[model samples]
Target: MNLIDKYITEVGKHLPRRNRADIEAEIRSTLEDMLEERKQSPSDDAAVIELLKEYGAPRKVAESYVGPRYLIGPRMYPLFEMVIRIVAAVLFGVMLLVFGLGLIGANLSGPEFLKTLGNSALSLLNGLIVAFGNIVLVFAILERVLPAKDFEKELEDWDPKELASEPEPDSEAIGGPGEQIVGTFFLILVLIVLNVYPEWLGVGFFDEGKWVIIAPLLSEAFFSYMPWINILIVLQIGFGIYLLRQGAWNMASRIANILLELASIALMVVMLLGPSLVDMTPEKLAGTPLADVADFFSKGANLLPWLVLGVVIIISTIEAAQGVYRLFKSSPRSPYPVIK
Candidate 1:
């Protein structure tokens, strides 16, 4: 083959299979035109080579365009962006609905509805933005670290690892009865201390008294703390004990997470429901002993939080119990004697 043809072949090898032929034809046609222009001058090999160099080597031209290939091209991503646009539109619609509902509720009922709705809308918007940002960040990192095309090729077929045996739960990993009791008590103590003086733990929203209310009952001497607080602590302790006895740390952690979620929900419910439960008629509510009125409203408002917390706690407990039952059921038991 001639030098020009050899150079053309080398350059064509570097181009993608889809565009290689078209690119090769274009290069060949251009080179032929250059040769035709120089033929009349009868140029030496060095002059011809210099002319070809001026046109740039095929590899250099190819390398300039050899960066990333996108699943969604930049042009398409910007002008035809589907996911983000759809998400934003949905969120806007949700905001409008929430605002409309808030207006209707407030006009029909009272001003407190407006306050609650506004707070909830702001929170929802903030949470959605934060969540969207995090998800985008995670996906961007994954794309950079592990290209989707390569990942797809690698995982196209399954491997034996897919069916590998899972290890049985070791008795040693789950401590003895005594150790469990001690560990559970320690966890309970930490949870309680964190609740009592939450700022001490450096967690966000700890200072928000909405986390745990300490309402003064009618008989203050009889109860130094709110009656519900005592009930919750007892329930939490019971939950902890159950976790320890079952040796289910996973379940315990989930229960803890659910408790935190319920706490936040309780705060929202209070802000929404507290004002309505009050005797807003002015005369009756104002004339009644302030202490008695405060006590009644506080007690009533307090009930919802506990009730919501109880429902969440119960649901979490049931889920955990089911998980534990499934795990134990799948585990193979050995033929051994237990000391009764």
Candidate 2:
């Protein structure tokens, strides 16, 4: 066969059947026309052969038409595309909730509950908005790397096995170290707002200083160390910042959970032991550093607050454990890789 014929046949193998013959004919005609222009004489087989060689083999030419070009191929990963979509929807929904609450808090006026409800709703809406924005940012980046035609093909052939069987992806799969940092930063933020916020943890009779349940005379001393609970708060905030800066949310979260868990267990122990410990009395303080304050308060009432604190600690621990378990044990499809 002639060089031109061979070239056409090779390229045609890669094209769809419907377009194969048409594309082959077009290429053949174009090459012949070029040869004719170069025809200084009636028969110039050598020139035609040289032209076909310079043009390239048919298969190489056909590659240009076979698929949409991408800096990153969609086939490079099938599951990641779906993961991005799901995360995007969830993030959008959360951002809407936060924004709605913020608007309500700004405009509404009412009793404590009504005011609080408005404020909280506004916070939730604002959070949702932030979440949505992050999701969009991630997806926008992925779009540039993906092949256009593969989008539909990916959807049509969605398969779980396809994802798991994908070659073990490196850290770059998520968006490199920088994107992982950003993602971890956002993850910690969501955790702090949802799990570690003080207003949510600071509740109950002791928290509000319910005088009827205890007594006003002993209230301040009874709960003076309550602010020490803020130690846990400080640690958690630090953890959030660490996760943001270092991209270690999974580890930081686990440590934070353990801290709260230990604190909770300590609280329960204190409650069991507080009543049995020595009483607070003026005479007991007479020679002590607190002597000046002895005339002010009784020991039992002072002890009462410790018991209350112990209760808070226990409750906080259980909550922290549950949260930690859920965070660490999410499904395989989770965007965040479970390190363990």
Candidate 3:
């Protein structure tokens, strides 16, 4: 076949099966018309090559025929981007927390310290890659499976009357979509690490030229609350996703937030009264040079549980209070007509 024919075939290969033949025929006809206008000999290979070059690469030409192709379309692009940033931030935060814990717990020589840092860095990089891949894959699947018209309908359903009735100058602003997205993403990572990859939460040390890892800092009693925590995480994730799509918080979201916060507080209270939340057993500390330090931790483990429980209660109380205030601030005013 001649260059033009070969070019058309290549373009056709890149096109969707349903429209390939029709698009190929149209492109070929257009090329012929253009060649006729240029007075280029179709039989001349050089002239055909020059003409094809002006037309552009086969892939580009096919793309033009296909129109704008997106793995995640414009409607979902902002949400997709927000999700990616949140996941990345959460991953970074988790890595930093892990590294800090290791630094505090592990006793290492200069070279061993450097090696540990290097390994932590590599692990963080890999985790980020995997997180990004998963996020992209999810969005891509949503893009394909979700009907465009459904999103359009959602857009159409919006009512201007639902806008905040009055501005509260003294009221604290609720978290924006970005903040909620990041918070939700962070919670998800916590759930996954706590449940699936608890070993990653441990400290590592070099012992007699062999690397040794300690048991995870969290105890089995802490894990007993995982199912409850998972439920909270899932709820928060759903709320965050709703805020992301709506691009604002409303009464519904505020109420959901308050409920989740209360649930978290209850769980923390249960944990505090139940059992020790930290595991610094002698066996976990045996091979390490920091046995004395570990013994101190074990002795002080009771205090550690109380400290953690106090922190959780304080944070959850603050969050719940904020949610209530936000709900009150956003409530519909009598002067403004409520949207049905």
Candidate 4:
């Protein structure tokens, strides 16, 4: 009802809801104690204002309680910056691709070419802005929802000797927040594209004067493996989420990663050895301008599945091998040589 109540109310406005009451009470108590110690009249409005001024502004006082708040906090800022850089690069690449495709079979030094370039730049700028906004929103949500203890421990528990010690085979950095976030994002992109926009697998070409998409490029045999492939991908996504929460890798995660990689490799191997994954035939393109090269491309299409699956299998195998070796390999992190 008085000046002090008004002051404390202002301070409470800035404090978090969870701690507002306790903090307001503490501030009131401290003010009262100071007034008692001063041996002054509680009704002295002028003296109370002076005391409040000494304590600092309401926002400043609240800040003292909560520390600094951010849309993206210190711990996640590095990852946010990295994601921004990646998104910017991807957008630039997309712009270049669009511009390059437009330049194809067109006069390069014309007004139309300049117009096309301008349109591409505008599209790229819009894309960059949207991507940046979405990334900030996601990181802001994560900053609020994620627990702080794991990050706190990572900061608090430090040993300078770690730099000198031999790298522990189990001490994998896959659980680093930056990598986990990037990996999860990439996996989700792949999941959406394959499941929701499977037609994107088709090749794009210019026909007559317009861009055309030649779809139905993948065969039924490829769709048959989707269930299994989706399962492994979903499992890996779940595992990645767990690791991000943990903020450090452990024995279980190491083992789980190897198993997932092996499963992927096995599935890829089956796709490679079994029925053809591509469905584009010479007959399919007979009506198009590509008819002349259709036969050559048809043969290459048969080999395309092999090329794609083989590359995936090889990468998976290499990753799995690393995980397996690390799981079994143990070496002392000693600075001293064996005395025996």
Candidate 5:
């Protein structure tokens, strides 16, 4: 009867576009079965009405088919969690490095000393909140933008064999939106901060109830590399977007990533082995509370750049290795022609 068709239409209107067709078909089939079981003709709209009533109203039926929504849906959740852990670890590691350096050649016991510690903790808390907000914002956008078809599979069609390949996804679906979004967000932020407010990367402490700043650690030696650094970072940003659009890594993109990592390693090596990148000149600290620690700042703080570069070099080498391995692993046989 037209009543059954109308009822299914109404239900379909309420369901997600991806699931609407299948659900509407299922509901229609069930209603038809009920009509047959009750020996009711399609012409008898009253009997069909009774069947739909028992099935529940369209809105209620739609609600039953769906559950709660998520800001970062189930499929991408593992990736989101992983990025959070990495970000937290990096932030804490940086805080520890800065705190240790600031403590160099200074009296560790005083009211101002405690204030310094409190300020560092508050700064760390603020950093975590900002990072979390950025992550959530990107993930929420991804959750709404990604297609629903990719989120889940039909439960009835699941196979035990899926466990055999649980660690790997389809070659085309590798390195999904989560990785791209998080990486690009942070990298862009780094570029902005370095270019716009590089002074934020300094040490500060209270000196006789007035705030004092040590010379910012970045030196002319480091800024000189900005052109090359800009090229690499901008290329990296573009490469990440390409991978997001491609939905997976291909041989060309894999090669591109490898080259980029190699370039990063080379830059870190040059910065590490070349002229000093950190300069905490004593002149700037002449009248500050931290004046006595000038030797510690100029010498000890200078070592931090080397430590950072070394760590970056190691990470880039590993990333380059992995990119090489995957590139060959997924490469296809070269095409050849033979003549009879």
Candidate 6:
């Protein structure tokens, strides 16, 4: 095709399907009319180049015809990006865990190991592509179907009173919105992995020239608490998104954080005090190298639950203290500036 035809074709590619032909025809006619007024020959390549340059790049021309086109608009773009990142991170973690298990079971050597790594890389790439594609598709549809006014209304619904920060003699920022976002993202991932794909938590062993899959390390007791755990995770994720949107923590969010922490502490207590939380049964360990360490596993298993419980208690206490401190710091009589 000639310069004019090629330029029109490029622009047409970006136009909506229904109006592409009409828009392309109009653009072509306009360009031809402009060239005629300039007394430039249509067959002259230099003239066409100069005219096309003045008309702008094909994308710019297409955008002009389309008028503010976006698969996902600016208002929703940040949330879209955040969701994509969270999904990608979760998929990466799942793939990494699977690859590690495969390596353990394959007993691969030299070239075999390299091949496994190559396969893993390809798998991760494909998985990410599918994940990101789905997320983008969902957001794109929402962009078109969800009314802009509704989103505006949602943004306007926030209460300024929620952001009242407490005063302290030597107050410091507890955690930024970024940190909360990252934390909640990983928390969501953990919840999904633990509940939806518990099998991925298992170890793999090569036995008798064949690969064997072990049961998950976590016991059935862990699964029993998943419903409640999932609720806590969802609440935490909502709170994190709120923080991200608001760009700062408020009195309400701090209280919610403490309550979530308390819920977590309560859940951890139930899990730790419940029946053996390890599924290291002899049958499960049989024919694996771990069988040799059965006694060690037993000993560690007995102490592991208590150790986890203690850690959770310590963290929860600290978080609760911080929340209380922040509440007191944001007192009306305090001289420190409130977040609102």
User: Which has the better lDDT: candidate 3, or candidate 4?
Assistant: 4
Estimated TM-score per prediction? 0.32, 0.29, 0.54, 0.55, 0.51, 0.51
Give the whole-model CA lDDT for all candidates, comma-separated. 0.53, 0.55, 0.77, 0.82, 0.78, 0.78
Question: Weakest 10 consecutive residues, lDDT, candidate 2?
Answer: 211-220
The residue-level lDDT of candidate 2 at 239 comes to: 54
**1 against 2, candidate with superior TM-score:** 1
Higher-TM-score candidate of 2 and 6:
6
The total number of steric clashes, by the backbone 3 Å criterion, in model 4 comes to 0
- Better candidate by TM-score, 2 or 3: 3
Model 6: lDDT equals: 0.78
Error of 5 at 132 (Å): 14
List candidate 3 stretches off by more than 4 Å: 34-40, 53-56, 165-340
Model 4 misplaced stretches (Cα beyond 4 Å): 1-169, 206-211, 331-340
Tell me how far the alpha carbon of residue 29 in candidate 6 is from the true structure, in angstroms, after superposition.
7.1
The backbone clash count of each candidate, in order, is 0, 13, 0, 0, 0, 5
What stretches of model 1 exceed 4 Å from their correct place? Answer: 1-68, 71-111, 145-162, 167-292, 298-340
How many residue pairs in model 5 have overlapping backbones?
A: 0
**Candidate no. 3 TM-score:** 0.54
Cα lDDT tens digits for candidate 2, 18-116: 888888888888887887787633245678668878777666788777765544354444445545544554454454544443343243454644665
Error of 2 at 326 (Å): 16
Q: Candidate 4 on 83-126: residue-level lDDT in tens?
A: 88867765776677678777754557779799889989999999
lDDT of 6 by residue, 1-340 (tens): 8999999999998999998999999989999999999999889999999999999999998888779978999988998987877667666666676677668777579887887788788899999998888988999999999999998998899677754543222334435444565577677878877877787665556678565556567787768887888898888888777766655455677778888888888888888778877776666766776788766765675576688778878988898887878767743465778898
TM-score, model 1 to reference: 0.32
Error of 4 at 322 (Å): 0.4
Q: lDDT tens digits, residues 279-339, model 5? A: 7777776777668887776677788987888888888899999878866675444356655
**Of the candidates numbered 2 and 6, which has the greater lDDT value?**
6
Can you write out model 3's per-residue Cα lDDT over 175-267, one digit (the tens) per residue?
A: 555466567667787778777878765556546654456656778888888788888778878877766666555566677778888988888
